[model samples]
Target: MNTTPISSRLHIAIFGRRNAGKSSLINALTNQEVALVSDVAGTTTDPVSKAMEILPIGPVVIIDTAGLDDTGELGELRVKKTYEVLNRTDLAILVIDGTIGLSEFEENVLKIIRDKNIPVIGVINKKDLSQYSEEDKRKWEEKLKLELIEVSALKKHGIETLKMMLIKKAPYDDRELSIVGDLIKPGDFVVLVIPIDKAAPKGRLILPQQQTIRDILDNDAMAIVTKEHELKETLQNLGKKPSLVITDSQAFLKVSADTPKDIPLTSFSILFARYKGDLEELVRGVKAIKKLKPGDKVLIAEGCTHHRQSDDIGKVKIPRWIRQIVGGDIQFDWSSGITFPDNLEEYSLIVHCGACMLNRREMMYRISYAKSKNIPIVNYGVLIAYVQGLMPRAIEMFPLAKMIYEEE
Candidate 1:
C-alpha cells in the first residue's frame, strides 16, 4: 500500500454546532480544501474523513462531522451518526461558534467526550468575525471548565498553536504496544505461515500479514514467509530456528504440529488481540465457548465492510465451526464497520474480527462495552485456537495472558 491504512492512523474528529466554522477549521488544519465549506449551516451531512500527514503527528485521519444541534428527523439521524464517530476518535476538537459560545449541546458533548476519556481541545472558531470581552471569554471557559483557544480558520491564525497542542496530547507518546516487535529483537528470524486459499486476497497478503511483516522489518528482524503445507519443510531447511512462528488462524493445527515446541507460535489475529485490544480479556473470553448452548446468540463483528464470499471466514466458516463445536442451532448475527450493535444484551458471545481496519481506540471501546454488558468477547484467532485446543500454544508468546489462561 502506498499510504498508511485508515486503521493505523490517528483519528481526530471535529465536532461543533451549525455555522461553527468546523469545516473551515478542518480545511485550515489540513491546509487544503479537505471538506466542502460554505456560509451555509450543516453543509457536512455525514462524517467526512481525510487521511493525511501532519508532520509531528505523522499519518492522521481528520473527520468533519455534522452539527449536533441540527433539528428535524433527518438532522437527528445525522447527529446520531456524528455521535457514533466518538467510538473511533482518538482526539476531538470541540469547535465553538465565536458568536454563540458554549451552550447545552456543547456541554453534553463535552461530558460524553470526558466520559469516554478521549483527549480534547476546545477551540472558539471565527475569531476574526466575532468579538467577545475578555470577561465573557473567561465566563464561557469557566462554564465549560475547559481552556479555549481563539482561532480564525479563514485567517489561518492560531492554527500552528493547535497543531503543536495536538502533538503534545497524542496518546501514543505514552503507550508502548507493538504487533510482533516486542516478542523478538533485531536479527532474529520469524517464520510466517500463510495459507494460499480461495479466501486469500488476490496479488497480495491480507492486512494483518502485511502489517506483521512491516513490524518485523521495522524491528530489524528477518521474516520468512511460507504456506501451511510447506511449514514443516521450511522449518527443517532453516539455518537457524526462528524465535517465533506466526501463522494464519486457519492453519493453526498444522502449523503448531510442524513448529518445534522451542519456538513460540502465534497467529496474526492473535497478535492483534494484544496490539489492538486487551489480550488477557480475550483470553478469558475464549473460555466462554464451552458455555455456549445451541440456542445462544453470537455476534460476529468486523471492523470493515466488504462483499461476503461463499466461503467467507466471518460469515460462513466461523459460524460453521462454532456450530460443529457447540452442536446446536446457535443464532449468529453480524455487525461490520463504523457502528457496533447497541443491542448487545441479546448476545451470549461477541466474536470480533482482528480489527485490522479499526484503530486501537475503537477496538478498546468495543471490548469495554462488551464487558459493561457482562458478555464474553473473543476475537477470531483466539476463538479458533481455543476450539481447536491449541489456545495455550497460540498465546505462548505473551506471558501474562498465557499464564492466566493456563492457571484458570
Candidate 2:
C-alpha cells in the first residue's frame, strides 16, 4: 500500500487542441491506454493524471488536459480549469496538430505559459500523417519561437526522443529532499527517534524517515533508530554524543527534554521543511500557535493517505495537544492527499505535514496560497515545538534559521 500522493511526483502537462493527439501522446509515452483518445474535440474536459515510471526519468505524473481550441461557454469553463493546472505543472508538452500550424488557442496558451516562465517542449504531433519538408519544420520552429519536435503518438514514434528531451529539459529533480547530509561529518552518529505508536504505518517507515536514513548513509554517517522510550538509554549507551537527534513530531517535547541542548536536536518534519526551502516561513507560522484561542478552528493538513496507527497524529494527537495548550475546545479540520478546502478563510491556523510526497514547487505553492490569504501556515515539527515550548531548541540545529528567528 504505497498510497503516496501523486502530487509528490513530477508533474508533466500535455496541452493541445482536441484531436491533436494529446491523449495519444500520453498513451505512447506511458505505453498504456491511460487516457481515452478520440477524434472528437474536447474529449478530455478535465485533467487526467497518470503516474508511471518513465525511462531515464523514474516516477512522473503525466497530466492530460482539455483541448485549448474548444468553443462554446462550456469550453470556456474547461479552459479556465486547464489554466489552473499551470501553477503546479513542472513541465509542459505543447502538443499541436502537425498539419495545422500553431493556432490562436495554442498561441494564447503559449503566451500564458511563457508569462509564467514554465519550461516547455513544443511537440508537433501527428507527424506520421502530415509529412513536413525540412524547410517547413524549420519554418514552424521559427514561428513558434521554440524548437519543434515531430511526434506520431498513434504510431508510437518519437517517444524515445521525447523522453530524452524531458531528461535534458527538466533533468531529474535530485533536490526533492533537503541537503541535511552536508550538515554532518562522515562517521558522525545521528539518532532518529521513530515513535512506533498508533500513527506508525504497518509495513514500512514513512518517506521522510526513509529518506533521512538514506541521506545519512549516503554521507557516510551512522543513523541510530529508536523509539521515544529508548531515548535516555540510547543516548547513554552510545560511545559519544550523537551529532544530531531527529525525532517524530509527536514526540518532540519528550525527546527535546531528554536530549542535551548542547547536541543539535530537530525533527524529521523540520528537515523536510528545510529540504523544501521554506524553513524560515514555517518557523514564522509557529508564532501563530500562541495566538490561537479556545474554539479556534485549526486545519491539520497531511499530504499522504491515512495511517493505520490508532492515535493518528493528524486526527488524534495534534488536536488533543492543541486543546490542552489552548485550555479549551478547538475545532480541527483534516485534509489529506491532493484535496484542500476551498474556503481557507475559516481556519485560524494551518499545520501541514512534512509534505515528503509533494515536490518543492507544489509545497511553495501551498505556502504561498496560505500567505496570499493572510492565513498562518506551519508544519508538524514547528507546531509541535511551539506546543512543547522548545521552538528555539529545535530550531537551533539550523544556524542561519536561528539567526532569522532571534532577529524576528
Per-model TM against the reference: 0.96, 0.86
For candidate 2, write residues 46-149 as lDDT tens digits.
Answer: 88988887656667888999887778999997887777677678889998798776667777778888887789999989888986677987876787798888
Residue 216 displacement (Å), model 1: 1.0
**Model 2, TM vs. native:** 0.86
Pairs with backbone N, CA or C atoms under 3 Å apart (clashes), candidate 2 = 8-357, 198-309
Over 1-408, each residue of candidate 1 has an lDDT whose tens digit, in order, gives 227889999899999898799989989998999889988888899999888777777899999999999989999999999999999999999998988876888999899999999999999988888878788889989998988899999999999999988887777735567898788999999999999987787899988999999999999999999999999999889989899999999899988888888889989999999999999999988888878998999999999998788889899988998899898889999999888999999999999999999999999999999999999999999988987889788887678998878875
Model 1 gets an lDDT of 0.90
Regions more than 4 Å wrong, model 2: 1-9, 45-58, 68-84, 131-140, 171-179, 292-297, 307-311, 323-332, 345-348
Q: State candidate 1's TM-score.
A: 0.96
lDDT of each: 0.90, 0.82
RMSD (Å) per prediction:
1.5, 3.5
Count steric clashes of candidate 1.
0
